[model samples]
Target: MVFQCQRDSWARQFATRVVSCRAAELRPEGGGEPVRGFQPDDRGLIGDVPVLRVTRRGPEAVHFVQAALEPGAEVLLSLDWERRFDHMQQHSGQHLITAIAEQMFGFKTTSWELGRQRSVIELDTPSMTAEQVEALERSVNEKIRERVPVMVRELAADDPEIETVRSRGLPDDHAGPVRVVDIEGIDSNMCCGTHVSNLSDLQVIKLLGTEKGKKNKINLVFLAGNRVLKSVEQSHSTEKALTSLLKNGPGEHVEAVKRLQSSVKLLQKNNLNLLRDIAVLIARDFKSKPVQSQLFVLHRKEGDSEFMNIIANEIGTETRRALVILEQDPSLCPQETLLFLTVGDEKEAGLFLLAGPVEAVENLGPRVAELLGGKGAGKRGRFQGKATKMSRRGEVQALLQEFVSHGSPEA
Candidate 1:
């Protein structure tokens, strides 16, 4: 977990020699055009002291490299050790992983990134197999264990060694020395990010997974050093929870879950058959007893709507019996309930309305639905609707009772 940081700069008070200049005095470097109102690289404070660090060379007039310091002004310069170390470990691990993939499987690393928690390398290949990932994990960790030296050198653009290195490309305004990193005998590539001095400093490299990326490429997700340990801890906790819930060992949880799902399905089927039978019995008893005008059953609970519909259908076929089934609103609204109405008279032969008059039942669904604060639709004397206001159930029931008794819903 050793960290090596090269890019981080600390603001220290440097000797200042102020000089006046004009716009025309600016000189662009590497033959680039001059820009106006430029900014310096770094800024910090120490008591009454203000310091600026020059990070890059630019036009002489617009960019000032130094700031005047009052006599006896104290200065402070510090580095974020944890941040520096994390960046080094991830960046160095990336170069090693990229090199191993390219050398072993011919899967070229098109690009890579050093994220906050994890890093990813985009490969030129469209997809990767489980076996390929395993192979990569094995080869990369092997190099980490070997602890190869990482050498950085600034090479001239025309140098012979430059031709042997793998590089993304130089910047468009290139004019300086090309800095290249060499992972001993494994890889040598041009990079600007900070990195560890040796493969052993990375501790380990773990390839978590891969996903299909844009333009038919593959992205390899990975974690290095302490991050790998954190992921392992979190995954272990989740497995323990799943094992306890399933009442089985981690290896047998999948089969245990499958068995539970199958049992649930069987129970649901049996419950539905029993409800249908109960509906038949209720309808038959009502036919024999012949209650006043209509046989309306209201249950205030979840799962009663299906039973209501079945019972209504059974009651619809009996002589002189019209059905109005309502279930209480699960949402706790008294005026809003579910209604299932079917006015069928199968015993009436050709008329089909003698058992429960069709004219009386035809328009009842719409009015009942309106009282229930919703709309409904039906044909051939069967309909279902929602009542937005379950409190209005009395009005709906009264209307249905009138229709069943006097052969007119309005009556």
Candidate 2:
């Protein structure tokens, strides 16, 4: 999960900036407890340049490992295969994407940050417009489909030609030939990160987002393989829903969807007119009733929040003594049920307790706020919620009924 950075201010000299301590390089190995069934050679690579296996905290991140270089660096490791897979996806993805970007845009990948969830590579040039990104994405996908071999070859650190390899990561030693990854005729870059067995194995490469940075550094973040598949499935499901809603035949799905979107604007206007008329009628009905004693509850199963507000205001303000309850979330109860209560200016205390087992109120309300939590108080028979305890709602209601009948001022 950790990598060497040339941009840091600590030391410009690569070797001076870095010291190799094998035990220190890998975080999992830093602790005192010995690993079970781990051989000495299982750390990262075949030699001194370390490759500590990443440990993922979520589906995407490697955590708890310190990435700085140390003298005689040892590696810490996690045994999770997903961590290794993430590295493989990102590293392999980098090779394909960067190579395509280079060929298409005349840009070089200057650096990259291998993050836990997604990786970002910096380009040497910036201002590549949106169209270029889209085209590059398509080309990378094509390259992956080609399923070209990804080979890792190690050379003596002393080889002169090692300087010719395009690499994101270069070790300080000129003493040995270098380690280079050759992607057939496409790319040859020096890197220590894990990679997929073949280009096809990397599957999909999705450019999630990107950011422009200083000195023309474009930070491109993307996902590969399974992540891309899941995203595509989710988008397809949404599209199908949209298509069905538009009432368009499958053959004309796109046209249907566009038509529906346009129709919805007009439909919304008509629906609003209907709702406003309904609100007026309800207001008139409540104003005509006995103001001192009216209880009205209105519910809309389709989750129209405005409808709830409309009915509540009509009944409560018109009758003055009306208690209008409106809810979209019916808990576990039937969708039609909503609760309301009303009382006159006599201030006869009444409680609308939805006190019951949580199961009873599961679909019942936001009323749990009042029933269990003792959340509210009022002058007349109008008290509401901080729903707390679920038990004894029925008993509490019965007791309050008696208090109201007896003309108690509060309950």
Misplaced by over 4 Å in model 2 are: 1-90, 106-127, 134-149, 155-178, 184-186, 196-251, 294-303, 315-411
Lowest lDDT block of 10, candidate 2? 4-13
Model 1 backbone overlap count = 9
Candidate 2 differs from the real structure by a C-alpha RMSD in angstroms, to one decimal, of: 13.4
| Index of the highest-lDDT prediction | 1
The TM-score, computed over Cα atoms with residue i paired to residue i, of candidate 2 is 0.47
Candidate 2 per-residue lDDT over residues 178-224, each given as its tens digit: 55777888988776556766888887898876788777577877888
Q: Which lDDT tens digits does candidate 1 get at residues 1-411?
A: 111123231112333332332232233455665534323322233223332222333212122223343334333433345665777888888899899898888999988878888899999998889999999999999988998998777777789888878988876655656778889999999876677788898888899889888798999999998778878898899889988898889899789889999999998888778866876786566556623234354533323445666655555554322222222333431121123332222121110011133444456666666666665666655556554465555666677666555656674
Best candidate (score: TM-score): 1
Prediction-by-prediction clash tally: 9, 45
What are the models' TM-scores?
Answer: 0.52, 0.47
